[model samples]
Target: MIEADRISKTYARGVYALRDLSLRIDKGDFVFLTGPSGAGKSTLLRLLLRRDVPSEGQLIVGGRNLAELTPRQVQAYRRSLGFVFQDFKLLQNKTVLQNVALVPRVLGMPPSQQQRRTFQVLKWVGLQHRMSAYPLELSGGEQQRVAIARAIVNDPVIILADEPTGNLDPDLSLEIMNLFREINARGTTVVVATHDRELIRRVGRRSVTLNHGQIAELA
Candidate 1:
């Protein structure tokens, strides 16, 4: 579960990315964060991931106050959640399997377990056949699928995807959305930040809309 209480993020030049934003996402819920560019969608996600600290207010994720965590604890906290980005962010030099295996490898998971989980998740995303391919060798949709596989390989408590389907075709976008739905059904909390209104409407999940750095609607 995640809670943000009157959180605000201000950058150096007197610019505010979020203004007194308050929201709560319960465990096992799927939510869409829809807003135009500069509306604080990515800022909120970054705050949740502890990639950046809020300039004001509090953020609690999985019962731990983000503001109070030590640097070491922040690293551990990140491992408990998965992040997927608009750009796939796959390593161009690493093979699909290796890229997906990076997290567990970094966490000191045993080689056998890493191999097993990586392969299993690749299959889940229907990319098992392309495991040995590099990022540039695959299509855009394939690359995103690999990203999804990498995100879920560790079975994190929550998944935060920022414009996950931003680069794919409409059909592929729907495919990715359905994949997120499936992941949500399996009990992982999922929050996606996107401006794709058509996709959001098609999915029909609870949506929160932001305008001018503040939540304007929740439906």
Candidate 2:
């Protein structure tokens, strides 16, 4: 779960990327964040992930205050999250299996356990057949599926997807949205930041909209 209170971000030029923003996402909820460019949707995600410190206010994710975590704690906090990006940030040379295996391997999971978990998520994404394929060899949707597999390999409790459907065709976008819905059904809290209104509407999830760097509406 995530809670943001009175959060604001301002740049040197006096541009406010987020202004007095506040939100609460409960466990097992699937929420869509929709906003145009410069609306601070991505900024909110970055702040939650601790990729950027907020200019003001408080953010608590999974019960840990973003402002007070030690370096080690922050690293551990991130391990509890699964993240997908607009661009599939896959390792070009790594096979799909290897890409999904990286997180568990880094955590010192036994080989058998790693293989089992990797295969399970890949199977969920319908990419178990492509385990040996490299990123370049896979289609855009396939690559994004691999990215999703990699993200959930460790069984993270929260999933943050930023523009996850931004690059795919309509059909593929729907496929990805379905996968996220399934993941949410399994109890992982899901939050996606996207601009595709049609996709969001089709998915029929709760949505929060932002404008002028502030939350303008929610439904």
Model 2 sits at a Cα RMSD from the real structure of 0.9
Q: Which is the leading candidate under TM-score?
A: 1
Q: Tens digits of per-residue lDDT for model 2 on 94-178?
A: 9999999999999999999999999999998999899999999999999999989988888889999999989999999999999
Q: Which lDDT tens digits does candidate 1 get at residues 67-140?
A: 99999999999998998998999999999999999999999999999999999999999999999999999998
**Could you tell me the TM-score of candidate 1?**
0.99
lDDT of 1 at 49: 89
Candidate 1 C-alpha error for residue 182, in Å: 0.7
Question: Could you tell me every candidate's TM-score relative to the true structure?
Answer: 0.99, 0.98
Candidate 1: residue pairs that collide: none
For model 2, the stretches where C-alpha displacement exceeds 4 angstroms are: none
Query: For all candidates, what are the clash counts?
Result: 0, 0
Per-residue error (Å), model 1, residue 75: 1.1
RMSD of each: 0.7, 0.9
**Range of the 10 consecutive residues with the lowest summed lDDT in candidate 2:** 47-56
